[model samples]
Target: MADAPLNGIRIVELAGIGPGPFAGMMLADHGAEVIRIDRPGRGGITIDAKDPLLRSRRSVALDLKKPEAIAAVRRIVGQADGLIEGFRPGVTERLGLGPDVLLADNPRLVYGRMTGWGQTGPMAHEPGHDINYLAISGALHAFGRAGEKPTPPINMVADFGGGGMMLAFGMLAALLHVQRTGEGQVVDAAMTDGSALLMSMIWGFRGMGRWSDRRGENLLDTGAHFYDTFECRDGKWISLGAIEPQFYAEFRAVMGLDAPEWDRQMDPRSWGPLKAELERRFREKTRDEWVAAFAGHEVCFAPVLGFDDALADPHNRARGTFVEAGGVTQPAPAPRYSASATVAPTMAGERDDAGVLRDLGFAPQEIAALGH
Candidate 1:
């Protein structure tokens, strides 16, 4: 608790799906005070009692359709350092929690909004999910085999990267501004904006003719043999990433390709044949054998580990990369800092509303009035 980086920060989260919850979790995991306003009753999709993703935060169930509930939220917002919500453009406005209303009362509050298409674009009001968001951003087009439709990358690209990460970034940016200028502003975190921003390097590559827009045709897209996964004799997979020439040479040496034909490592025309040959060689050894063969070498190899296997990995276990909370195992705090490293807390339920109200400097009578 002493090292909690965000210990004094207060955040009110308007509960929603996917990215919103994730963003809240990130802030809470770093020791910020996050209170999620849940839908009254066990409505919609219910979180499992032991859901790790929902840990480290408190919940306050409120039926925002009622005036009393709206008043309660406005009260909480009055004292909050920030607020995070992931809803479509007009949803908050209809609920009477729009930026203008909140900012008028709390000029220093950071109002963070997370959305798929953003607040003003034509697609802002359209209904879409992760795959659709990525497709619009050209990210999905670059993920599959040559001449094949791109496969979705397990919702990581759009939801977490584009959504949650963007929200967190915007919140932090706004918070910084508020601290310096004594003013709060709304943070518009659009998934399209975030996902497209993430693709800047790839776009640069394409503009420079170093990368192809076609799927599976770029060096880092698994088009090159040196940067792909290969199956071993044991039916397990191993990833190879020897991008630099020196590393490629080390890979070739470990694979016993020390002769004339192996010298064409950079010849574009020879890559296909070389990759085929390497595949054949890789198939002759089990995954563990391949791992052993290059244990101390700079071949840049790692076994394709499943979720469970990743937890037990020596390197991961050594770093305490995973932890158990609420009877569920999940990822630990990240982007470590020596002075203010975040620590995960073990809790699965919302703190009592009255208790949190007191912590926010509200008297007992004000807390009781919130329920009325």
Candidate 2:
């Protein structure tokens, strides 16, 4: 096993849905000793035996409604550096595992709370999903074609980005605070808040009058001809991200686009015609041919690859970006560190109660009692 960056950090994840497991996986990926507490009988939606994101972490199935489960969690929390939970507001408080109770026992434990809405809004208690959260966060509005109903970005916006990524970031930030002041704090990571934060760049663009709420009309939102995907000859697609003036010029030059007419780069009126012309040119070649042509160029071109294709790509294979573990091949750890690298383990299974408790400083007898 490689030396993990967060080997000394311990986290307890009270499992729910979506982002909770993802955030737990992120912490576990970086060498944090993350324990996922499942409420016995909670079946996961998808199970890939070799997926790397599921690596690391021990699981402990407990019924939080029971006194025994509550006590067990308290003991675990007492020794943990962080605790993450994704339940509707008040669920943890009702279980007696709330921030107030846990922080009282471990002043240095960062309590990370993940929710769709915020912690203190009128809609906090309302049932919602990724789509609902993104809708309210202004993310959905910035997606899809102009003057058309907004399309969902496959729940990636709220579930992973706003929910999981934000929770991880907030937990890390809180960990820094605990290290400084020895006082643990509650991290309210709401999907709505996170989604809005993800749009900070767009917000800045809007402030500078370079963006509009209408979708398919901005440089980054597929509104520009140079920053969108086009169909190729084989029915596959290729993405082009020649956003800057120099890159666009290089891209046009590579494709042999003529001057004067092609020089009208940022004109809104010329956008539709330019896109049509570019589409025609893109259709002349297969995705593979285009990839071969732009093998080493500043055109910022790539195939719109699916997951299976992504794993098989030459660049991905060369970099070992994906690994086979637990009979599955999934993405490897990211953001490599020079000194402390992440280790990729096989897919995790059900939580190992006795084994995990022993590692967390329980006596043999105590482990046996917990099993009972």
**In TM-score terms, which candidate is top?**
1
* Candidate 1 lDDT over residue span 1-372, tens digit each: 256888889899998888888888888888888888877665422345466556788777677998977988899999899999888999999999999999998999999999999899889999999998999999989888777889988989889998898898789888989889999999998888888888999999989988877788678887787889999999998999998988988988888787787777656567678788878989999998988999999878899998999998999999999998766888887767777868575656534666666776768787676661
Give per-residue CA lDDT, model 2, range 1-372, as digits (tens). Answer: 458878889999886667987888888888898887765653632233244555677777677878877988999999999998988899899989988899898888899999999799899999999999999989988889767889998989999999999999999988988888888999999999999999999999999999977788888888888889999999999999997888888898789987687898888778888998989999999999998888778888889999999988889999999887777776777768877888676577655667777777878887666653
Looking at candidate 1, the ten consecutive residues that score lowest on lDDT are 40-49
Clashing pairs in 2: 50-328, 59-351
lDDT of each: 0.84, 0.84
How close is every model to the real structure, measured as TM-score?
Answer: 0.94, 0.94
Which portions of model 1 show Cα errors greater than 4 Å?
Answer: 43-46, 361-372
All models, RMSD in angstroms: 2.1, 2.4
Q: Which stretches of candidate 2 lie over 4 Å from their true place?
A: 42-53, 363-371
